[model samples]
Target chain A: MAKDDDTAFDQAGFDEALRRRARMVEAVLRQVLEQRPLAGEIARPQRLIAAMQHGVLAGGKRLRPFLVMESAALFSADGEAAARVAAALECVHCYSLIHDDLPAMDDDDLRRGQPTVHKAYDEATAILAGDALLTLAFDIVADEATQLAAERRAALVLALARAAGAGGMAGGQMLDLQAADAPPDEAGIIRLQAMKTGALIRFACEAGAIVAGAPAAERERLAEFGSAIGLAFQLADDLLDLTADAGTMGKATGKDAAAGKATLAALHGEDWARRQLAGLVAQARALLEPYGAHAAMLADAASFVAARNK
Target chain B: MAKDDDTAFDQAGFDEALRRRARMVEAVLRQVLEQRPLAGEIARPQRLIAAMQHGVLAGGKRLRPFLVMESAALFSADGEAAARVAAALECVHCYSLIHDDLPAMDDDDLRRGQPTVHKAYDEATAILAGDALLTLAFDIVADEATQLAAERRAALVLALARAAGAGGMAGGQMLDLQAADAPPDEAGIIRLQAMKTGALIRFACEAGAIVAGAPAAERERLAEFGSAIGLAFQLADDLLDLTADAGTMGKATGKDAAAGKATLAALHGEDWARRQLAGLVAQARALLEPYGAHAAMLADAASFVAARNK
Candidate 1:
């Protein structure tokens, strides 16, 4: 482990890098969303665009986009391509948040310390906004402006679709819903976590490799690294749900426990969960050891995921 | 105009071809959905898959897939590639239906003569299934099996995404919702209908040319054919809502008027709408004239869209 001085320096660097990448992602997203599907005769509805912007521009931490950018950077992919892909991933993340906060889903009224999309807009607009954002992600990634080879772009699109689709995030959400009736065991909980959150994180890392046309071995390692950190992220999230307040977290935290969500942290006690997170972070760091100081940022990211308070 | 005998022959051929393509789309969809996103451990939640199947396989007309197939055939694209693309389009269509039928949206209880996905399953399941289906469409089209150049596949993904995104289907739905409060003029209604239904239809025709790498002029003409037929289809739909019963249509009819949707058929009398439909079909058929007999199926398609009883 790094000394306190080194850890603090790394943390500051990570924060600065995260904020910079997030800003870039935000700018790219704004530019992409500026495009209209029909330009000449038909115009984009102001209200729908407003709703979409509301869902996306809520100013969250933008962790997923950060993951995408940092991972892509590790493979020396084009910065523009990485930013475009990161923007696309952020769109998916924002869209999922909007839908998940709907009355039918998590039913939360708050996100990112503000009113949720469904709360800010009507339920219908919220749903449409989420749908539109989801659709836009693929569109942004596939655009020629991404400047990736056609095959790489296609691969990225396919991976993203898989990550977000059934058997992944959506399917895991279903499992989470079912857990209300009958909570799964630890293994099932882990599988659910892997699908629900881990899949996208894994894709974010692998996308870097695909965009860079990196070796398959490197892709696998990066994916594994992402998966480990993803698990660690979820464990930390569950911990925060137990320990943090709504004011800091930007949303209701205790709801997961109240809803009887079968999280790994719940399955194994808090201390055990913390240990697991630490272990996973260490494993993730080890995965990047071959890249040396070039991977210091990713190593710090893993630590951040394990240590984040909100 | 064709003679009565020729019309009958064309109609029969069109019917046979449509059914054949629909079946093919169904088969491809089933095969695609059979593969789990996480094969061994996470396992696709059977319930979510079931809900998706319920939404998709409930036996609608599959008109969109038919259009895709006929259009692709015009370019002599590979049958399998066309089938895969058609299947992807069907997935998006089915997903839109599932979402449109949500309680917060159109609130329809029945679809395709059966309970909607939300009615058959639950609202959350319906939303997730719809989400999964939408994600799955991109996955299917971007798959290696589509057998197109990567750029073509990327283009297809981008087109489909645009057709389904904020400026297209979802945005149009928002406009339709707004029309309930303040009805749009005739042009507004036409624009709404074009975005809501015409976008995907146009993409279906254009996708064929794209996959085949056809000339830009050919793509534009096919797109025009699709747009004309799309307008005709919507006019026919509005007329059916006024004329048909729930049983015949396999779902609620007359709901659009009740919802105060400002459709062209509602703006103009049914007779005028019928005349417009006829004009649009003629225009659609004329656009296909350059393709000669190779476009007979497309011409038949235009006629069928205007003439579909349900």
Candidate 2:
């Protein structure tokens, strides 16, 4: 383990870098949600645009976009291309949040301390906004402006679609719903979490490799790193749900426990969960050791995920 | 302009072709939705997969897929490639229908004489099913099985995203919801219809040219043909709503007028709408004149759109 002084230095650098990338992601997203219609578009409906903005522009840590940027930096990918892809990933993230917060889903009234999209705009508009955002993610990736080659763009689309589709996020959501009636065992919980959250985080890291045209070996390592951090991210989240308040989280916490959803954190107790998170973070860092200092920021990111309080 | 005998012959050929393509699309979709998960997928949740199949496998005209196949035939595109693209397009169409039938949206309980997705499954399952289907459309398009070049695949994804995004289908849904509160004028109605219904139809035609690698001029012409027929399809639908009963339509009829929504056929009387439909079909047929007999099936499709009773 590092000394306190070295850890402090790394924390400061990581905080600044995360904030910088978050701001960049915010700017790109703001521009993407502009009312001005793109070529071949008929017109942007104001109500829908406003709803999308409401769901997306609400502040969060923007950790997923940060992962994409830092991971891409490992291979020296073009910053502009990575930024756009990061924005696209954020769009998908926001879309899932909006849909998940629907009355039929998680039924949360607040997100990031503001009214959810359905509460801010009617349910119909919220649904449309989410749909549009998801569609726009693919649009952003495939558009010429992303600056990647056509093959790379198509590969990205395929990867994103797989991550977000039936056997991934949406399927995992169904599993979560089912778990309410019959909670799954440890393996089931792992699979459910992997599909629900792990898939997108893995994609975010792997997207960097794809954008940089990194070799398959590097991509695999980055993806493994993503999986490790993704596990840590979820474990930390479950811990926060148990330990943090709604005011701190800016959304409802303790609901997973209330709903009786099976989680590793809930199953194994806090001490075990914390120790596991530390191990996962270490594993994530080791996966990037081949890139040495070039991957220092990503290694720091793994620590941040394990250590985040909110 | 054709004699009664020639018209009968053309209609017979067109009907058989449409059925053949519809069956082909159904087979492709069934295979895509199999219980076996794809590469990188953790697992295919049975409930979600069943819901998707419920939404997609229910019978309909499959006109959109037929349009894709016929349009691709115009450019002599590979049959298998066109079939996959046609199946992908149908997925988007089914997703929109599933969503549109939600309680917060159109609220229809029935589609094609069967329960709507939300009725057959729960509202949450319906939403996830629609989301998964939409995501799968891109997956199918970007997958190697589509057999298109990388650039072409990227182009297809971009085009599909635009046609389905905020400024197109979802945007149009917003406009339609607003129209319920404050009905739009004729121009607004046209724009709404174009975005909601016309955009996808146009993409269906244009995708054929894209799959075949046809030149820009031909692509534009096919798109125009799609627009003409799209207008015809909506007009015929409105006319059917006014004239046909719920039983004939296999779903609710006259709901548009009941909801006080503005439509071209409702704006003008039946005679005027019929005249407009005739004129649009003529325009559509004329646009395909360059293809001569090779365009015969597509031209028949325009006539069918105008003349269909349901």
Candidate 3:
């Protein structure tokens, strides 16, 4: 591990890296969604495919995919494999957002400054689109094109399923919904946020570790790094909701508070929340310190999550 | 292959076989759902779990799982592995039914003689429950407990995803919803039914072959067999919908004609449909003849599907 004093971390370099990886992910995702494997068996339903295209092709920063790439880089995992896995993560993330934006859930019409899937399409289309995307994520991970060893792919599929399934993201969303009825304590809120958003983020990092065939200790450490940063990401998000408007955030702001949902930022004041975010980021960086320059980008990721405007 | 004069297929034997397999699938599903893997990470979210339980535990014939096990039996696959895989197929089947019964889709109040998931819970819960069950299906198949080679599991995951995703069940559903605006012709309706219902049923059979490590030709043959029975199953369902009342069918009857949906029975009349069904059953049975007495239950299954009252 190189000493910190060897070289300063470059924020611009990290941004460029993120942009390059995001483009790779975008291209892969386009090719993936373009596939009509059952061409002769069933004519691909145009409207459903159109809705899926609408749901997935809508752009975001692709932060989670970037995390996947950077984490994989720590062990020099295959770039194509990492990219495919990252795409899977992004699909699950996007699907959750679509479901969350439904009238029965967050009821949001806007996402990424455009109409949510349910708004752009009807309710049933939105529901099907989300469901299809979720299924597609697993499909991508298990695809032969991803080109990992079978066991490794199975491991990826298992970890991903757990992260995205009832025990992880979906369960977390359920808790979030129930919180609206009876607001949870601060601990409950943290647990909910951890499951709702953090679980996937954590999986993104652990996924890289799995892809890289890292040892158990290393995998655990990277996962811990992810958990810290996951918390930091959501905390930063809560802070932004309090501070930013729709124009800057590209979605409704302060809806969490309006819904009377307890958040760390809501429970604590802005100053304390800001301090907590810094602490979490620092903790994340320290966890990555053993990898030194190999983890420089990941350190930047934590900082970026804390500092992003949107 | 068995000769025509070899032996008579027994209806009673088939009924007992169906009952036995259904019971095995039900037991496995109950155990699978009882799991609380993330107990420490998050509270299991009882309402969501309950909704999932309600959706899956509501009694049905377990025909899909039976197909999975029976098809696997031809290759003498590991019984436990087949059972687990069958459970996963059942999860997908139940999830689809749950979503299909939602107010946004079928608006069904009763399913299997009880209030639908949405009716028993709420629209949001129903949606989430369906989503969770779908996720759980993949999880179970991907799990090490299934004990297949990782490559086989990956194949199963990929196949299941395609069968359940845009090119298959969900896409078929979108088309079904749109059919209300522009009712399809016979070919179009057949295509839609093949995808919407037949895809998963086909997967159940193909999954069995995959589990048994059957060759490509055998897998394709079983899949074709699945397609034949899939059509027969829908034809039977449509016939029952036309003939049976809510008391026997356990849900509203004749809703398809009311919705102006074009089923074979609706388009060709009951007599033509019955003849088509018998022909399909004969076709399904013929496909299994090569397996001899080993396929007696399957041949009986085909006849049973045609003759079923509900």
Maximum-lDDT candidate: 2
Worst 10 residues of 2 chain B by lDDT: B1-10
TM-score of each: 0.96, 0.97, 0.95
Q: How much is B113 displaced in model 3, in angstroms?
A: 1.1
- Give a tens-digit lDDT track for model 3, residues B89-119: 8888889888888767878888888899999
Query: Per-candidate interface C-alpha RMSD?
Result: 2.4, 0.5, 2.0
Q: Who is ahead in TM-score, 1 or 3?
A: 1
List, residue by residue over A1-310, the lDDT tens digit for candidate 1.
2223222336777888889998998898888676464431245788888888888876877877887788788888788899999889988888888888889998988787778888888998898888988998998888887899899999889889888888788888888889889989988888888988888888887788888889889988988988988998899898888778778776677888988887777777888877777788878888999999888887888888877877
Question: On TM-score, who's better, 2 or 3?
Answer: 2
> Taking the tens digit of each residue's C-alpha lDDT, what string does model 2 give over A104-135?
99998988889999998989898899999999
Model 3 TM-score on a 0 to 1 scale: 0.95
Please rank every candidate by DockQ, starting with the best.
2, 1, 3
Model 2: which residue pairs collide?
A: none
**Model 1 agreement with the true structure over B222-278: per-residue lDDT tens digits:** 888888888888988999998887778877788888887777787788888777877
Which runs of model 3 end up more than 4 angstroms from their true locations? A1-10, A38-41, B1-9, B38-42
Q: Ten residues in a row with the worst lDDT in model 2 chain A?
A: A1-10
Better of 1 and 2 by DockQ: 2
The all-Cα superposition gives candidate 3 an RMSD in Å to the true structure of 3.5
Instruction: Tell me the spans in candidate 2 whose CA falls farther than 4 Å from its real position.
Output: A1-9, B1-9
